[model samples]
Target: MGIIQNIKKNIIAKAMDKRKAANPFNPEYSDNFQLPPDAAEDQNNSHYFSVHDLKSRQSLYMRLALRGGSAPTEVWFVYRDGDGTVYMNERDHISKGESIPAAVECVEGGKKLRFTYTGPVKKGRLTDKGYVPDGNSGDTMVELDGNFSGLTDTFEFSRHMATEPVARALSREKFTKEFRAALSEHHQVHYEQSGTVTGSLKLGNREIVFDKLPAFRDHSYGKRDWNYFDRYVWLVGLLENGDFIHNSLIRYPAVTEIQAGFYKTGGKTLCVKNCTSMDELPVTGGVPEKFSYTVAYEDGSVRRVSCSLDFTVPFVFGGGTYFVNEGVSDFTVDGIKGRGITEFAFNADSSRWTRK
Candidate 1:
């Protein structure tokens, strides 16, 4: 009897593996995936900044975080080329109050990469318009010395959702009210647009300069555990024709949340009132291959957009998966073409690919 039971279990396990390998994107198999034991809840804040230069055919991304749990403050940097090749680095500190390191340098084989913050804006530099990284300068990949200026007003979520009943329900903890107030008062969760990026990026020892590059920055605070959301999608893009767009969508087990970003054009930036997005997931990896979205503004105008993946960097963090894609995009407003970055994250135990 014992031998017969062991045989049956072996056959069942093999069958499950085969099924997962055949259709890794199917959500039905997600139950078989497992999260690490350390995947606990936490309250934290993070800031993410990025730049994409079409002329140089290179993209740069950086992130800094103030953790609320056992984890310490951390920083991450990544540089990618048009061909999907990527070079990345990360650092962590034991103190949350510590500032972002002035420089990050990495060397591999015969290649070298360095990131330096030339003029970093101090914390709590909030103005009446919003938080701005005015006069901020940085160098990425040893070649690009980015000087960002002319930052637009900070964009935030609607007061009704961010402060009123909705926020209360979402943050139903012992200090719910105080937490929400701090999130806003400290400018913990906000995004801003920059009108210009003057710098140069290097590709294979060749230096490419740009007089103007559109850019954006965002910060978030509060409970930011990756396991808190089952899935998330973040997209930001800038066109050569002077148009910019940003959007974020988060899915919890019981509810879906959306934060429509600002659209800037013709020296004007307006918050997007409504957005609808459809993503096509790859069959084997659970990564997004294409995305389509429509943005509607208060003025009754809509813009349709589509993006196709060109370069990809897959990242795994705290039992979650992040597929970061740098690609070319198109907008229906003027058929404008541009390049930018998009990120999709999924909980490790809930992601379809984990079952495989």
Candidate 2:
């Protein structure tokens, strides 16, 4: 089974990197910068902005999208980390038309991205307030607008490389002492808990799907040892399809709160997590820059699986673009349909592609 789950994830990633170096946020996170300026080549094809600021500047942003030039279109991807912190992924309408996603033809570019729709929906708020030299370090904020309206179309395309360049922007005691010395050398090792992902997406008019647990390497973020990693989870994402996030590590003081669940299947693939309401994960129409989503997972028994998406691209940064309410997601959970998509990528952190 994948080499005994990579030898039990290298013995639990070395005992969670030594309990993340005795907690207390690992001496401010440790520094290791160097590797920023390299990938660039998007004159104006709509949107694509890969970014990274390791060595403790603590940054990692990404965006990608594709929409109907023809054949199985719609894709989106977004990943954020340098303080602003956001994470979005999408895939829209493509079950039988499957084609356009060789990573969006590995992006050579023809160019097509303008933005400006204003039909309604646009709002933001997320604060567990915990970072930047304060007393907390959970940080989050998302909102976007630049202005366009007239409406043009080429479908959209992106990969990110407008010339790398963004080495270090830290200072909050150098990104909390280099993210607590890199989580105390990544928690001494010993990791486990693998499996969970669902799918269903098609965004031109709108289609959605989700199953949760995208980034799970073991118990913390995946849940098991008093779960909910340090709290700071928020929700309101809607591009068209896909929304079921969970990136692990919690237990020490506990702080995880971006809870979600709205994806159903009778074939034994369900996710319902303590609900209050998101209308079960709906997402209305009229929004499409290009998006898709498909995720599946089952850890209660044997093993079930699903994850099929093309792409949905979107990006800008700081000033705001991140990815939110692109199509006005409605919401669902028991019937299996949580949705959103616009541009997203996952190969296990491609280093925030500057194109490289």
Candidate 3:
């Protein structure tokens, strides 16, 4: 099953690359909110930004998802300290506009995107015994003001990544009402860029300042219903040699899945043809472990990326149905040092993490 599926995946990936070359990703999408054709149903638009202050071994992250229907708009902010303490702030009910996302204050379209948070934070740390919380942090207000400025042209996952595997699996699977619901949760288009984030973060009066630190930004828009997914894992990081790497494996119900990612180095960006053992990547909360991945490029050439988790910030959204566990990581590819994040997501209600 894996062999045949992988063959088809490669073929589809090749076609995707051709289509992408012909249709060059539009720049306007970097800051624009686009609604899918099924606009009346479960459409959603979201923006994510992350910057690792390597010097301090800390980071600040933001995610804002605007959804259709009674689903509330979400604005989440996370700050990770050098000592591994995680501070999180989130608002589930917020007013948003048709073309404007709430909480993400845009200074300029793709060039500079700004985000801020002003609220009490929940403090926690994943330790040897398990997760330890500070009991709501007792009125501790966390404030953040940060902006991301792009360092490269945006990469469109829709164009370069393979979605045919999922489409083909869905075509053959019985589309029960449950399957349709799961399909609705998929995000059809995704855009991202490597950049720098600069701003200031305050935790009760002790302030940490950010000044042009290496970062990453992502924008995804389409219909999304979190109830459909089982789990997902992705890693994005920047090398000292000015290279950036991103790869993800998203799993859904009944053998449906998608693998998408690219590598940018030596002034060229290449699509990853396949990744090995992604389904087996461990997601653990104890002692901050590490993992390595072997990825084959379009030419079938492979490279090893060793990633180690330095610290993580965990967040739950979608009314307790979804969780995104993100970590600041140190990555080494061919002996070059890099730093960024690795995200592990779960449908909490149906996840092993929750069961444990």
> Which residue pairs overlap in candidate 3's backbone?
185-225
For model 1, which pairs clash?
none
Tens digit per residue, CA lDDT, model 3, 301-325: 6878888876665666666887777
By TM-score, how accurate is candidate 2?
Answer: 0.22
Q: What does candidate 1's lDDT look like per residue over 190-236, in tens digits? A: 43444465666554445657575565555455456555455666777
Which candidate number has the best TM-score? 3
lDDT of model 2, residue 353? 16
Better of 1 and 3 by TM-score: 3
lDDT of 2 by residue, 66-125 (tens): 222232222333333333333343233233255533131111112211121112111122
lDDT of 1 at 211: 72
Ranking by lDDT: 3, 1, 2
- Per lDDT, the best of the predicted structures is 3
lDDT of each: 0.49, 0.24, 0.71
Q: How many residue pairs clash in each candidate?
A: 0, 121, 1
TM-score ranking, best first: 3, 1, 2
